[model samples]
Each structure stands twice: as C-alpha cells, then as structure tokens.
Target: MITLIRVDDRLIHGQCIVRVLADFKIEKIVIVDDFTASNPVLKNVFLLATPPQAKSVIFSVEETKPNLLQFIENNENVLLLMRSPTVALELFKSHPQLKMELNIGPISYRPDTIKVTSYTYLSTEEIEAVNEIAERRVRVYFNQTIDQKIIEWNEVKNLLRSG
Candidate 1:
C-alpha cells in the first residue's frame, strides 16, 4: 500500500532519506520521472542517495503508467516520489485509481515559476495542473519534511487566484 505520494523536485535527497523515509518506515520508493529513469548517471545518483534500508525503483512516466497499480498493490508501505506536479497529474489522469492524497514538497525555483511557498513554486501551467488534479478528487498538500506544517492545496489555489 502507498504510505505517501510525494512530489519533490530534488527527488531522493537528504531530507527525504532522513526524515520522510524513517517517519513513514517506507520500505520502497517508486521514483516516477522520465529524466532519471532514462539517464544512467542521474539514475545512479538517485540510487546512491537512497538509504540501503529501503529499496527504490525508478521508472519513466510512460513506463510506470501500466505498472502503477501493480506497484502500489504489491508493495507494502510504499512512497511514490515525482519531480513535479505535472508528473503526478499525469498519473492521476492516466490512472484515476491513484486516488490517494499527494504530498507536495520541494519544487525548486525555476525561470517561469512563481513561489507559492518557501520550497514550493509553480508556473502558470503547473498551478492549473494542480487545480485540475484537485478537481479529480485528489488531495494535494505542501510539506518539505515530516516536521513542517502542511500547506493545503486549496490554500495554494487561492494564492494563485489572488496573485
């Protein structure tokens, strides 16, 4: 079963490995990102970052689509991590059965993106994509680590609409 569906641009990093993993006792990490899945160097980097206590599998969005259900059903205490809202949105769009609430973490500042929170930023497209995901009945929240306060999706939605 999926313990958490996290969106963190840095993918698997210290914060994730130290705080989130131990907090959830996540036995498996299913990284769903195209860039990391295809590039051996990037994939190796993520693999190295992951703690040996937990196993991780990297898969591209397209590759993960068909196997998503299996990944969730077969694994116990799984944490699915993606680099962006778009990636999580894709999964929800293709596999609506992924009805679990999504946790939004660090989304590093980028050229076209606006800061929604200290660690969370979104471009116009990303904001809309997030809104659509919520409309699909999925809950999304911003939380950098297990200790931080979770900023709800509606709060983000309102912030985007106002500014």
Candidate 2:
C-alpha cells in the first residue's frame, strides 16, 4: 500500500532516505516520471541513490496507470514519489481508486515559478494542475519532513490568487 505520496524535485535524497522512508517504513519507492524513466543514466542514478534494502522503480506516467494497482496490492509498504504536482495529478487521474492525501515537498524555484511557500512553488500551469486535483477533494499539503508544519493547499491557492 502507498503509505506516503510526496512531490519532491530532488526525488530520493538524504532527507527522503533517512527521514521519510524510515518514518513511514517504506519498503519500495515508485517514482512516476517520463523523463527519468526514458533516460537510463538518470534512472540508474535514482536506483543507486536508494538504500540497498529498499527497492525503487522509475516508471513513466503511462506505465504507472496499469501497474500502480499491482504495486499497491502487493504486501509491502510503499512510498510513491513524483517530481511534481503535475505528475501526481496525472497519476491520480488514471488511477482514481488510488486515493490518498498528497504531500507537497520541494517544488524548487524555477525561472518563472511563483513561490507559494518556502519549499513549495508553482508555475502558471502547475497551479492549474494542482487546483484540478484539489477540486477532486484530494488533500494536498506542503511538508518538507515529518516534523515540518503542514500548509494546506487552499491557503497556498489563496496566496497565489492574491499575488
């Protein structure tokens, strides 16, 4: 089952391996991203970065639609990490059955993206994509680590609309 779903640009990093994985007892990490899956070098980097004991799979958004259920059905705790809210929104669209709250991690500062929160930022398209998900009643919150304060999506959305 998916114990945690996070959108972190850095993917599986030190904080992820040591904090998120350990706290959630994540046995596997399913990274849903087309760019990462298409590039073997990048895929290998993510695989190598994962701790030896934990299994990791890099699947394109399309590939994940069919296999996501199987992964969830398997008797193992899993952490589903996406590179962006856009990707998570895509996954949720195809697999509506897989309903879980989304944890917004590091969105990373980009050239044109607006800073919604310290670690969460959104571009024009990203904001719309996230709003689509929020419309579906899926809870999205900004949280860097297990200890960080949770910032609700509505609060962030209002901030975007105002500024």
Candidate 3:
C-alpha cells in the first residue's frame, strides 16, 4: 500500500532518503515526474541518492496511470513522491484509491509564490490545486521531517486567506 504521498520540489534527496524512508520504514520510493522519467541522467542521480535497501523507481504520470493500482496496492509499504502540487494533484486525480494523506514537503520559493509555511511556498495555481485536492477529501499537511509539528490543511487555508 502507499504509506505516504509527498510533494517536494527536490524529489528523492538526502533528507527524503534518510528521514522519510527510515522513519516510515518504506519498502519502495516511487517518484512520478515526467522530466525525471525521460532523463536518464537525472533519474540515475535520484536513484543513486537512495540507499541499497530501499527500492527506488521513477515513472511519469502517464506511465503510472494504467498500472498505478497494481504498483501501490501491494502489501509492501510505498512512498509516492512528486515534485509539485500540480503533479501530486494529477496523480491523486488519476488514482483516487491512493492514501488520503498528502504531505507537502519543501517547495522552493519562486517570485510569484507565497510562503505558506517555513518549508512550503505556492503560486496562485498551486494554491488552487491544493484546494481542489482537499475538496476531493484528501487531507493535506506541511511536514519537513517526521519529528516536526505538522501544519494541517486548515492552517494552510487560513494562511492563504490571511495573506
């Protein structure tokens, strides 16, 4: 089963491999990104970053659509990683049977993006995508590491409303 679905701009980096994998006891890390799927060099870089014990694989959204259920429905604990809320939203939309918890990890600041939390920044479209995901009954939270305090979906909504 998919243990966690995370959105981080830097997908499958040191922090993700070290913290999330170990803490969650994840058996596999499935990265769904078009760019990484198509670029062998980038895919190898992400794969190399992961430890030997953990299974790491990269698949584009389209590549995953047909066989996503088979990939995630197994008994093994899997962590689904995506680089953006847009992609995460798309994946969730395509595979509605996925886990309900959507964790928002590091989102690099862009000029047009607003800081929702210390680690998360979002553009207007991203904000809308997040809202749409929540509307689908998926709970979204901001978490960097497992030990940190979680910022729930309502808090993000409040931040967007206040800002």
Best by TM-score: 2
Clashes of each: 0, 0, 0
Kindly list the per-residue Cα lDDT of model 3 for residues 107-161, writing each as its tens digit. Answer: 9999999989888889999999999999999999999998999999887697578
Per-residue lDDT of model 1, residues 59-160, tens digit only: 999998888888668757889899988888898888877746989998989899999989888888888889888998888888888678988988768757
lDDT of 2 by residue, 7-107 (tens): 99999998898899888889999999899999999999999999977999999998988899997688888899998889988888888877568898887
How many clashing residue pairs are found in candidate 3? Answer: 0
Descending-lDDT candidate ranking = 3, 2, 1
Off by over 4 Å in 1: none
How does model 1 fare in lDDT?
A: 0.87
For each candidate in the order shown, give its overall lDDT on alpha carbons: 0.87, 0.88, 0.88
TM-score of candidate 3 against the unseen true structure = 0.95
Q: Who is ahead in lDDT, 1 or 3?
A: 3
After superposition, the stretches of candidate 3 with alpha carbons farther than 4 Å from their true spots are none
